[model samples]
Target: MSEEKNEITLKNYQVKIQDGLLQHLAEFIKPLWQPKKIAVITDDNVGPLYVDKVEAQLIEMGHRVVILTVPAGETSKSWEQVQVLIDSLAQNNFVRSDGIVALGGGVVGDLAGFVASIYMRGISLIQIPTSLLAQVDSSVGGKTAIDLNAGKNMVGSFYQPNLVLIDPSTIQTLPKRMLVEGYGEIVKCAALVGGSFWEIVQKVHQPADIILQAESLIHASIAFKASVVMRDEKENGLRKLLNFGHTLGHALELIEDGQLMHGEAVAVGMAYITAAFEKKGMTAAGTTAEITARLAQVGLPLVANQLGSAAFYRAMLHDKKIKGDQIILVYIKKIGEPAFYPLKITELKKWFEPILNSQIEDN
Candidate 1:
């Protein structure tokens, strides 16, 4: 097949999706940025794999490239790591005119994007998301964040990147588990939008099947997200829909304490919440079964059994979605239709207790 070329124009920047764009990195960067110094922030896992090639492209463009690699994983998305990167930038003299390139999965994107936002009160950022999860979800949105003791993505900013380059070939290096982890987000997106995207996602019978459809899937995902972000860049209204499973997902991720990857936690969250709401007659009948089947097809866990309802609830109390005393819960009336229900903090447990309790009992 001829290499797919798709571009999404958001409110502030552009997202270019192609199969081999990474090989022509300089061509893309040349149009949006002319910075003399560019800090390429990535994780150790990704650095060893792609940093040299990325640096070569940057160097070819006559840009001073600084490779800042941090430990790979969620733990790296912390205040101390942020400080470490800031010091590195300062020590190397990264001025306001210089740009930052986030070159890994979600953690690296979130951490480096946050640093780019605050250093010198904000600098240009370019997101070169490697992992499937990052390319499909985190990289497109421009919602950068770091985790806190309280919850995931608790500390961060709404900093848009000047450009986003997604090369699906990078996903070839991801392990099976990592690819499945990414499907959690892809499934979440499909669940929210529904229709053909949802249909396409459900057709995948195995993890490797996703690779066959990566470029098209990435394009569809980015297009849907870009449409949402263009309307509600600050997530004040329309963009809130994107938090479909994130509320409980973040809590489950926190309570699991790294045992659960972000996408897996989201899979469990989506399953539980859909089932719970369906039982209460709030969601469309059979929606839970459909979602559960899809999640199972990809080997995503449907239940987080280690923690009880109280612990999960406590973690959720710190979620960014909680507005004052009410938390907005996103659910579907049926496939292709999603609605948000705002529940008071005091009544949040009523929504999750039955499903969680049953899960505990089963375990």
Candidate 2:
């Protein structure tokens, strides 16, 4: 409600953050795309809340709308689900000219986006990210994927959406835990950028504070990611910085078996890696403590003390960032100044040994 509406233009698409964008879905889609059919992919949880309204708007426009609902959770991001969605699209007689509307959280966005990318060798994609996690991070980036047993986002594509429509008001429906899940990514963005954004984020003492400032915070997070995506669409160089906590975060996610939310896992990854790198003289002094304090302020976990170091290492080996014998890790020289360091796979265990051991001893 702060601004009511704001727009950020990216290279291939535009992100529209509006207070009641959901009600105006048809108005927005008319200008961008006019497919014969629009497949609205969502989850059971969100379908009951928003899909009927979305379908009604699309139908009012004389466009055929199909509602495909998956179960609500990370498990929905799988090959099985992907195939199910793909079959749904095909069975509905979807074609290259048809479009897809991903109408839920990150899981829905990624799964539906992946389907949109491959169905008929790619169709139009419009992302309507309802959750904070999707609005701030995943929805804008165009990175679509389904998890493999080996790792997160193992099977995916850099398929950008034609438009990203964010409704901040929808976040009011999210539970406190889901809202905090989003802060993980928002804090990650602030730590990476290290300017006014970081200052604004640092002052937030709790999840309620973020909700009060949701509009501005969501816009800032999306704008930062849009800039990075524009500069490095393929994540070739500078874009790698966006993976700040993702390397070990994905590993921790795999180890916990979905016990941790993506943002929570990444929060722990960012804290632990920064601490380890600071000890090795790779990160700036106090950077670890600063990042830790900010994460804790938002109620994000700082470490997975119960998990062992070896499990993380094994999981990290499957990381996409691994090239040859080294895996690229992003570290903060300080808040707002992020740098990438590619540590040899052989040396990874040695680097994290003390931190892992101490965590076990403390337990």
Candidate 3:
């Protein structure tokens, strides 16, 4: 994708996904002005690979750097680990006025930014997202959270970043499976509000599509999210649409008990939701099949029999979208336009039987 095309205009945040974003890192950070000190928070998975480069870039620009490394992945997003990070900073005599730089995928970004949010009540957070998943979805939003065993992202905060530093060069090293996993959210964005971007998405799913063409997809997904987050930074309304496939998708993840990746479950979840929409006579006749087939083509299953829909529904009750105990789902009225529905538990239960069975068969 052309660097020019990756310039995304969010409601308030500026999300730049171009190739040379790092070339102007100094300029980007300049806006934040000088800080007493800066901490580069990363995870085990990412620290060894890109930490030196990121840290060196900052130091060369005359910033005091402290590197904090956490164990990689989701576990890092826990209150326990967060406390450890806080204690570490305190022990190191870091001040509240200092800023933090998060340089990894979603887990690192979420955990680090979250620490910055509560540390001394609030501080600056700079997101230098390396993974495609973070660049396209989690990195920019002030929405930060840690996972709970009962539910993913059960505890968190919404603290916007002071600056977002994206470098497509970092995405080149992403594993193929992880890369494919990241696309689930992008597809969710497309299904909900992609507009003409969906045409490109459909092509990308083809087995013949080249992986190197990811910049185009990444930019489109970011643009989609940028629009939503801008309208509803607090997630009161419009931003909920981005959860189109996430309701059931998240439930499936809980049901599997960390067995399925976020994106994989979302793939199945989107299929199930589209199916329900078709059953309600709300969707185009072929939409369900087309959606399922596309997910399948991309190696994401339409059905996951790992856990029954009954178990899944139980998990749904705990979702943030649930009103008390009822499911107020984020569903698509049509592509590019989203609707939030207050669905009765009983009403949703009706569709689970078939969706559950279908998921089993797919698995």
Mark the 10 consecutive residues where model 2 has the least summed lDDT: 354-363
List, residue by residue over 130-184, the lDDT tens digit for candidate 3.
8877887888668888988888899889988876777877766787666777777
- Indicate the worst ten consecutive residues by lDDT in candidate 3: 354-363
lDDT (Cα atoms) of all candidates against the true structure: 0.86, 0.86, 0.76
Off by over 4 Å in 2: 1-5, 358-363
Q: Per-residue CA lDDT of candidate 1, range 6-47, in tens?
A: 888887788888888999997789987874899999999999
- What value of lDDT does candidate 1 attain over all alpha carbons? 0.86
Q: Model 1, which residues run further than 4 Å from truth?
A: 1-5, 359-363
Q: Candidate 2, TM-score vs. the true structure? A: 0.95
At residue 226, what lDDT does model 3 achieve?
Answer: 71
The regions of model 3 sitting more than 4 angstroms off are 1-4, 9-13, 20-24, 206-210, 307-309, 358-363
In candidate 3 the C-alpha lDDT for residue 353 amounts to 65
Per-prediction RMSD in angstroms?
2.9, 2.8, 2.8
**Candidate 3: residue 260 Cα off by (Å):** 0.9
